[model samples]
Target: MSATISPLAPKKYPKMPVIEGVRIATAEAGIKYRNRTDLLAMVFDPGTAVAGVFTKSKCPSAPVDYCRQNLSAGKARVLVVNSGTAKAFTGKKGRASTALTGEAAAKAAGCSESEVFLASTGVIGEPLDTNKFSHLLAGLVKDGKPDLWTEAAKAIMTTDTYPKVASQTVKLGDADVTINGIAKGAGMIAPDMATMLSFIATDAPIAAPVLQDLLSRGTAKTFNAVTVDSDTSTSDTLLFFATGKAGSRGAPKISDPKDARLGAFRR
Candidate 1:
């Protein structure tokens, strides 16, 4: 979500400019809520770098499983997220459903299944209807775009009172790059990560490894440092996507957390 004049916090969230090389789509696939967008898909530029942090819990959602395995591929072309029914504890079917969603996302975005990152949040133990993905995802091509960040953030929320968003600009080579982030957590926040979901995007050029390091440290400070209740959900997820289309802006190299560049990045 871009920055805004939110009454909940009275802090203005940035009205972020649309990042280049990204497409977004949302639909009420009936995975849970009715007449509301419950599913969101983001198609990144083919060369985008992606990184993620998941709940330390061994028991995770089917979509979480899909992401964990695909992360090994070290690339992501699209992200498919849903709220309402978190397909956790359903064992094999959960895994299968996640795989199905990834496949559908790949096809819709013209990428491989391994390039899709998936996540879900909502009622646990309920078997997710994987068919809904094919039916609803087919229509997202027209709805997905960089400006839908806020909708995407809110769609994945479980118990958040107000949507969380942050944005900043940094120098990437000769060009100025911007990072936009959104988080959801009002309950179930504790432990290794917290029952929260966050996505941060930037228009810069960075290797996936460097991006992962920055994301790990950033989340450790922000989400890991905050809490409301003392429970962490099985669906906790964090992701960072770098759309390299921002051109060859020479961003200062981020070597360690102590590097002064992170001050611009983390802020």
Candidate 2:
């Protein structure tokens, strides 16, 4: 959303493919900025698997705690993300904001509160007003579509000069599957994990545990390898969602990260 793009940014953004069972919508809630989107809502079909890597900072954001607790469920129905005021170091108010936002997202997605994931970015220690955007969840869910990757990436950006996105298609067993990812980072570059926030979606039929293993391992070589500064942000978060819609196209279900059938997809 900045007037200038990063010199290291990709010359041209890739065309993001739509993954079945995944829908996204973005809104401008005026949480911190005006005339630009700052809220993102992503809905996943039931049974979608999820994995994540977050900041190692001891004082993490409230949304980080909310996600860590719900990750054990191994299922995801919705994701709500915001940029501007990170809900961190605000004690009870931070927790209240996450709970209220999660409840709103769950109601809109028709899923349990335990199935919703949340992430926030920007200035830390500021009390986030969940009401600023929580009320827009129902409308986002109703208007969401599967091809808004560009807008979704832009909505969650803070200091980043440009939206970062990547996509790849590979054969998962006998079926073809696609991976689409978007990331936001610039100033807080030394991610213990990248205020770096990233989200990836795939149509592969992989289980949550396997997705977790793959994501954890992948982060070590990618996000965790970059260092832009000595300080790490408390709001850093990365998440992946697998919708398993590829199963209908003959992709075999994978429950183990070491499965030889995923050889090509692993690379």
Candidate 3:
């Protein structure tokens, strides 16, 4: 299904560069919504570092569980996400569903099953039929396009009125770096006020721990302070990616949001 956008979806889409070793694709598995894309998958390089923030809810989704269990690895190559079914409950099935999704995405992307990341949004406590995704997996991959920016925003949505996107290009002297980000928010917004689900991709090279530190520090100012309905959602996620395309040495880690140098990117 085609995505719904406020105005021109394509032109308004955020074109995130395919980093040195990353590629992304989204599909419409009819998990919940019909006639529109709903599943999202992102494939990273062999050594891509990973950092994340998730819901503080006592109960979380299967994808959240899978990520929490493997986050210690601190590395990823692919990310598989689905909307229309939050999979927050349903016990074992939810967990199995997440694993299946991750494994399937890994197969298509040609990476270890564990290396695949997963996330889900929408209705909670319902069982997700992994079969739905299994059938769409191949076609979803074959039809993948590098220009599905707006579709990414529309796919993960729960009830967002407008697609949330932001971009910043920061310079590192000889070469400049660019950061493109997309987010979904509408209700269940109160966090520890922790950062929400934000995915940012950059063309600079940075260490994993350093990237994690950067995201933690950056959130205190932007995502953590916002409010939508005073209620927080069961799923909150954020990630930062370094395409390693800028060729910067020992990338600067800005743990302090006020680090003047980051001001340009932060804006």
Candidate 4:
């Protein structure tokens, strides 16, 4: 936790709503910090479509590389994030750590390794010990529940003055869809493409390509517009996951980003 909260911090944190197909759990891994949680895992139900935007920095973190490769799959089962040891510029060790962590998360979620997404933030150039948290995946998967959004936000903070969270419930076609987002960053702003790190999950039935389109367009005016510093972080990342669970409740399947039915959601 940061000793001094940022003056720009929100006056009050909003109550985060639970999205139907997401479960989150946090653990204390002591990666580069002590006496606080430094690891987080978010499990998404099957059929979750994913989209993301990352820093355009020439040198990105190992987790950033892993996510860029996996994003093309457009599907996600689990997201693993750590707050200390950025896992950047560590060469072979960083890549090996990400691979080990992804494999461990996949096994815990009973999903393919390619479907696991990862992000890391904090000090760059230090080797992250995957062992610090990989063994906790099985337990985290079993203990995770859908209502720990606030805790999940805090667990992934590096120098964040406060946990950032936002939620919105809107009518999508005939069903109500909810969007919940969490972000962490107090420094290393001026994102070339994304914030320091953020994750959003919703129960809307949007397709991957369409979700990517929406996320990319939306980020331009939001995350991309904010700049706390001129430096772009190598670990900047933002991911959005949409679990198609709302389809069962009559939410229209949106495969096109320009569909008129997305009017409310687009706002």
Top model by TM-score, which number? 2
Cα lDDT of model 4 by residue, 1-267, tens digit: 669988988888888988999999999988988998988999999999999999889999999999999999999999999988899999999999999999999999999988999999889999988888899999998889999999998998887878888999998998999999998887767856544699999999999999999999998988888777688889889999999898999999999888999999999
- For candidate 3, write residues 1-267 as lDDT tens digits: 223544533465454554455565777788886777777766666777777777777877788788877677777877777778887877998888877887787777677776767778788889999999866665665556655555676677766656677666676444567776777766667764432456767766655666677777777777888775676666677767765656644445544434555445544
lDDT by residue for model 2 over 1-84, one digit each (tens)? 468877888878899999999999999999998998999999999999999888999999999999999998889999999999
lDDT of 1 by residue, 1-267 (tens): 223434576355567667777777777777665676777788788888888899978788877777878776667888888877888898988888888887787888788888889888878898887897666776685457778777776677655545567777776545688888777665677875677777778877666777887778777787778666777789888988888766655655443445555555555
Model 3 TM-score is 0.83
Candidate 1 yields a Cα-based lDDT of: 0.75
Model 1, position 253: C-alpha lDDT score: 47
Would you give me the overall lDDT of model 2?
Answer: 0.91
Worst 10 residues of 2 by lDDT: 187-196
Ranked by TM-score from best down, the candidates are 2, 4, 1, 3
**Which should have the higher TM-score, number 2 or number 3?**
2
Worst 10 residues of 1 by lDDT: 1-10
- The segments of candidate 4 whose C-alpha lies over 4 angstroms from its true place after superposition are 191-195
For model 3, give the 10-residue run with minimal summed lDDT. 1-10
